[model samples]
Target: MDQVTAAFDATPRRDFLPRAVRRRASYDGPLGIAAGQTNSQPRTVDDMLRLLDVRAGQRVLDVGAGSGWTTALLAHLVGPAGSVLGVELEPELVSFGSGNLARTDRPWASIRQAEPGVLGDADGAPYDRILVSAMADALPVALVDQLADDGVLVVPVDGTMLRVTNPGAVVTAHGRYRFVPLR
Candidate 1:
């Protein structure tokens, strides 16, 4: 199986889901979380992670990390040698995501709150791979700037899934998708 699928299989999706929707954790569709956010559908997450092509020791950033499901998946992909930083705009989600992540016992990954209007984590700049779970009206410059040379960023922009590489030098649209707007 592909690395993305392996990561998905290893990580328990239900662990990141709210208790109210825990029964539907294995459902293929998105489910509501706190702070008016919804976890990205399983297929969408799989597609993005495949496009990202994460390695075993790369630094990754997960933006709009609502429930930390994707973040945990990334952590699994990166393994113990690598690290992942998940940034959320909502304070409650930061706590919720962090709490969910704590159960994994993976010290290489963490979730924190981002200031309003901030698109990515500047403190963790030069990410080897970046994934944005929320939709943006246009490509978020801050996120692109955070990419290392030849880095890949998978994000939803204007209803399309866009894979950006080489620090915004190359952008490929991978068809349509729905996501909550990035705050």
Candidate 2:
């Protein structure tokens, strides 16, 4: 298995899912989580996680945290010295994500609810990596602005998976991917 799949196996996406959502764990389709949002597919989540290129001691921001699976994975990838913040637009999702993340062994992972479209928690500025879970037309400027000078931003843009590293260089996949639209 590739590193992403290995990570998934290590983390077990099922463990992060709520009881109501566990049945859809292997569906590879979006499933409802807390609030009105849906958790992203495991394959897509894996792809994004690979593109993130997370390293130990880096801070990560997970936009549209949903059930907190992606956040948990990132927290594991970055290890204990690194911190991860899962931000959701709905307060209830924030609570749900927190509960889900609490089960993980990583103590550096946490959830924060904020207005949709806003990027990093201003209080937690300068993230080394940012992963936007929901689909979007383009990289939100605010999110790009929040990146640490050496950071990386991974998102789906223009029907393709793209990575935007600090200094504004964009590397897009030659293929297209379908995802739930960004709110």
Candidate 3:
């Protein structure tokens, strides 16, 4: 089985969700989380992760980290040698997500409140992989610049799931996907 799939089995989705929706964790559709955000459908997240091709020791950035589900999964994928930084916009979710992440005892992964009017964590640039759960109207040049020389980013842009590699910033569309607009 693929590493992403293995990660899914290792990290229970219900652990990262709000109590009200924990029973619905196995549902294929997206579930509501704090601050009107969705945790994203499992299938979509799996697709994004497979496209990203995250390695065991690559540093990853998870934009729109929502409930820190993806962050914890990324931490599992990277193992102890890597780290993951998840940034979320809503303060409520920030606190909620932070607490969820803490339960996993994965010190290498953390969710932080996103800065006002800022995109990803700029200070932690040069990420080996970036996964954006929100949708953008167009390619976010700012995020592409955050990539390391050979980094990869999986994002939803204009309804299309795009796998973008650094260097030339090559982009390939996977399929159509719906997501909350990027703030």
Candidate 4:
């Protein structure tokens, strides 16, 4: 439970979650968010965040942000000097997530609905880290190119593989991660 405690201390998962979901947040089961998608459980979130190796003062792009739970966590991880841009495909869902973020005291969190599979606001290019919450059959080349030269991109590929891409490097691993498929 150390990881879970760390995440909760850094960012209250319940704060990013919808009121309805706050009641069900756990590491054992999937929790639904807006747009018919679900937030991976607490343990999953911890694992993914660990894999991303996010640090303070690093700009992060949260692709397929559901209720902005992970985005909020990134905001906390990056602190006030850094920013997190949450891009989702459904406008209403984006609005919902944005609203959730707006209620937070954190100042570096923001959300936008965009064409699916896109990353970072074009205006906010070259993020230090990119975390795609949803899985895809293949890595989205666009996201890799959006990364800063030394940036990291963590994506779940082929629905069962986790791939981390960086300049001159690409790594993949097989795993059972339950996430809404990236569109």
Candidate 5:
């Protein structure tokens, strides 16, 4: 398997899921967690990671990190040299995701609560890669501005998945995908 797939395989999904739905951890479908948030499907996560092309020593931003699954996976890909910051709007989910990520022993990855309507971490601006799990009505300008010179951002806009590149100058649509709207 490729590196991304290998990372997915190595990271235990069960660890990131809520106890009640732990049994379906490997189901490959989205499962609801608390606060009306749902983990993205495994396939969708994989696809987005592939598009992001994350690499070791490359800092990444994970927007709408529900259960910290994507955050942990990105941590694995980025290794110790890189860092990952996950932003969630829900306070409970921020705690939940932080707790889940703590188990991974990856100090480089962390989850934090974001203010309502905030797109990305401005304080942690200029991310090498950014992955948005939730769908936005349109491209979030703030997030686009946060990308590094050659950064890549994979986000769901309208009903399609878009891979935005560098300074947010280019946008390529991947395909249709359903996701919870970004709050």
Candidate 6:
């Protein structure tokens, strides 16, 4: 099995969800969380992670980390040597996601509130792998700029999923997808 599948097995989605929605953890579809956000669908998350092709010991930034589920999964794929930073726009989700992340043994991963009007964690730029769970009408140049040389960024743009590779910026379309618009 691939490492992404292993991460899913090791990190349960239900752990990141509120108790009210835990029963629907296996639903495969997105579930509503606080601040009117949704935990991304499992299949979509898997696809994004696969496209990211994360390696061990690489730094990753997770955009729109609604529940910290994908953040934890990325942490698992990167292993102990790597680190993951999950930034969320919603204050409620920041606390909720951070709390869920704290339950895991992946000390290298963390969730924090995103700064208003910021596209991504520029202060923590040059991320080896970046996973964006939100949709943007246009490809976010700011995020692409934050990628390290040869870094990979998987994001949804204008309802289509895109895999962006740095150091030349090769872009490939995966398929149609839906997510909350990037703030």
RMSD of each candidate? 1.0, 2.0, 0.8, 2.3, 1.0, 0.7
Candidate 2 colliding pairs:
none
Note the Cα lDDT for every prediction shown. Answer: 0.91, 0.80, 0.93, 0.77, 0.92, 0.94
What is candidate 3's local distance difference test score? 0.93
Model 5, 114-153: lDDT tens digits are: 8886788988889999999998999888988999999999
After superposition, the stretches of candidate 4 with alpha carbons farther than 4 Å from their true spots are 1-5, 116-123
lDDT of 2 by residue, 80-177 (tens): 89899888887887888888888887889988877765565767788899998777887677777888988898887668887888766555563577
* TM-score-based ranking: 6, 3, 5, 1, 2, 4
Ranking by lDDT: 6, 3, 5, 1, 2, 4
Regions of candidate 3 where Cα sits further than 4 Å from its true position? none
lDDT tens per residue, model 4, 31-112: 7776688877777777778778888899999988778778888887888998898898888788888888787777788888
Clashing pairs in 6: none
| 1-183: candidate 1 lDDT, tens digit per residue | 988889989888999999999999889999999888998799989999998999999999999888889999999999999999999999999999999999988889999889887779887799999999999999988888999998999999999999999944599999899999888
Q: After superposition, how far is residue 59 of candidate 5 from its true place, in Å?
A: 0.9
Superposed model 6: Cα runs more than 4 Å off: none
Each candidate: how many clashes? 0, 0, 0, 0, 0, 0
Q: How good is model 3 by TM-score?
A: 0.98
Provide the TM-score for each candidate, comma-separated. Answer: 0.97, 0.89, 0.98, 0.88, 0.97, 0.98
Clashes of 1: 0
lDDT of 3 by residue, 1-183 (tens): 889889999889999898999999999989999777999999999988999999999899999989889999999999989999999999998898899999988899999999978999779899999999999999999999999999999999999999999789999999999999999
RMSD of 2: 2.0
- Among all windows of ten consecutive residues in candidate 1, which has the lowest summed lDDT? 167-176
- With a 3 Å backbone cut-off (N, CA, C), the pairs that clash in candidate 3 are none
| Model 6 agreement with the true structure over 9-102: per-residue lDDT tens digits | 9999999999999999999999998898999899999999999999999999999988989999999999999999999999999999999998
